[model samples]
Target: MEQLLTVKKGNSRTTKIDVEGVYYRDLNAQLRELSSKGIQNVQLLNVYGQRYIGTNLSQPMEIEISGTPGNDLGFLMNGSKITVYGNAQDGCGNTMDDGNIVIHGHAGDILGMSARGGKIFVRDDVGYRAGIHMKEYQDKKPIIVIGGTTQDFVGEYMGGGILIILGLNLSEEKTYRAKFVGTGMHGGVIYLRGKVEQYQLGKEVGIAELEEKDYRVLHDNVNEFASYFNLEPNKILEHQFIKLFPRWLRPYGRLYTY
Candidate 1:
């Protein structure tokens, strides 16, 4: 793999890399080197489907990706901010510990699978099984806010964290179309802006009215998401929202005998 790393020093604490056709390994190696050199910010141009672009990066740096990134874009990333100008592929933030990933466009399936901490904001719709198995610890909780609607199984087997579906593009009268939502969900909460029918949800999931705390969470996250995608937060929040949570601590606890 040819290492095409062009480090052009900007005004202060910024480095720009023209990663047109650089291999993933070489690109990551150069990125690590740049981070070690105290480069606080990095801008990658023409970043097309480079898997693991910001994997396991523990630095508190800011990385801006111009084009679409491949799967596992920020896997296990500890502390950093990644802003993607274009859409992203599957598993964007797989098992991320702590950080922020802001996607200006749509994302693929399993958006935040098992992410222990951090936040993922998707401007448009996503594929199936988003927020699958996402969990949280004592103080660390992951959050994912989808600006548009999604496909089936939005929060399958989620253990913890918060998932919000804004449904900004859907009409007011249209019910949420996703099926088998929150299937086997044990923990966490999913908020949907539009109405959902009882048949569309899993047996273990139950609907609830949005509380004051729910509004606060939605306000904070939606505001942040709107700022990233240049949308009006107030208009987005004007619609009514509903919450989905697991009815039983162990949905399948009866299947096995100890």
Candidate 2:
């Protein structure tokens, strides 16, 4: 008898994992047979508020959840890789189409909502529209990396990929609690660190500083989000990173069509 399952506590919607004691007797079909048996490091003894924990996996496994995981945790995922220690709710990786989801603690609200591909790494501090309406196809570019400090519309209406928000220490109090950032953004790219004054972004979008090929893709995505949440990647490269796109919108002489 090489099977150990335990999810004996309540209120979860779409679970499945068909085997290995099967959640000690059908805990939503053992979370859908561990999302169709690509179980790589499954150790979730007693997860409580489970809702779509690793939904619709394709392959590539790695799920290690503990507690407090509800509300679209990897909803519509393609490929597979999930890691959550605690504190996750509301669209953690909803609409994901690739792999990689890591939330050590703290996350709620549209955290990578409408993702069209993969990559979501959040160490802490997240809530409100964190990468809301994120999208990207063609190259399938989807990436959201948040270390700390996020609230309000982090990247609303982003029609592409690459959104990074890092605050870490979180309060020199200049600007962290973002508001109305990138409203109706026609494309992608949103990276914020600190010192935004009163932080009110929208109106198409236009902000700069941080080139050199976007500092090598934000220093390789903040050094892989501080090496997967361990921190101290030169104090996140000593701050100062704010870049949003989509500004020069001069399509044609649109008084009337030609």
Candidate 3:
């Protein structure tokens, strides 16, 4: 049994939910029910470590989460927009097909793992293997922007899409801390705004000069990210950026016996 309460706000039809002592399943059930009834905006309060907060939701709604959410926050989500005012746990956008996830604080490991389409913006640091195995097809391409530095294996096995690491909090001379970056990445590009030593990159990845199209992509995404966190986009874009891409389409193709 779960105890939850909902209150309707004036005019806007926004529903506020108090999820104290409510099970994750029950909470998600209520969310689905509300969305099915054409409720487009919801605010969840007292959400302490509830896993799968917005999993597999395809409706075009806005969900505001106030407390720290547990793992798999928006797994396989489509069309819904989720804004987390607090920190998020591991696998934030696992295989998400569409929508936006804006995190005000840090995020855990494997953020945006294998997301096919959508955007994820983190205002602070992220843990290991952020953006691992992400891919894109046709008009659907995922994008992830991290404001702070990350741990090891960032963008490991990424097949497509865009990844941006702003490194805003780091000193000008300090190199990025992540190692084995873009390991086994075959497609897509990664934009890093800080120093990275040669040893930090995987052998399969190579650095390239930014082109006009690349600049456009960075400008749009960085501007959006800066606007979300109330930072100046110009100051963030003033620094140099390095592009990382795979040297070969299949780095391990020779390893397999075909």
lDDT values for all models: 0.89, 0.74, 0.91
TM-score of each: 0.94, 0.35, 0.95
- 2 versus 3: better lDDT goes to: 3
Backbone clashes, each candidate: 0, 11, 0
Model 3 over residues 78-186: C-alpha lDDT tens digits? 8789999999999999999999999999999999999999999999999999999999999999999999999999999999999999999899567587899998899
Compare the candidates by TM-score and give the number of the best one: 3
Clashing pairs in 1: none
The order of the candidates by lDDT, greatest first, is 3, 1, 2
* Model 3, total clashes: 0
Error of 1 at 113 (Å): 0.5
Off by over 4 Å in 1: 1-12, 172-175
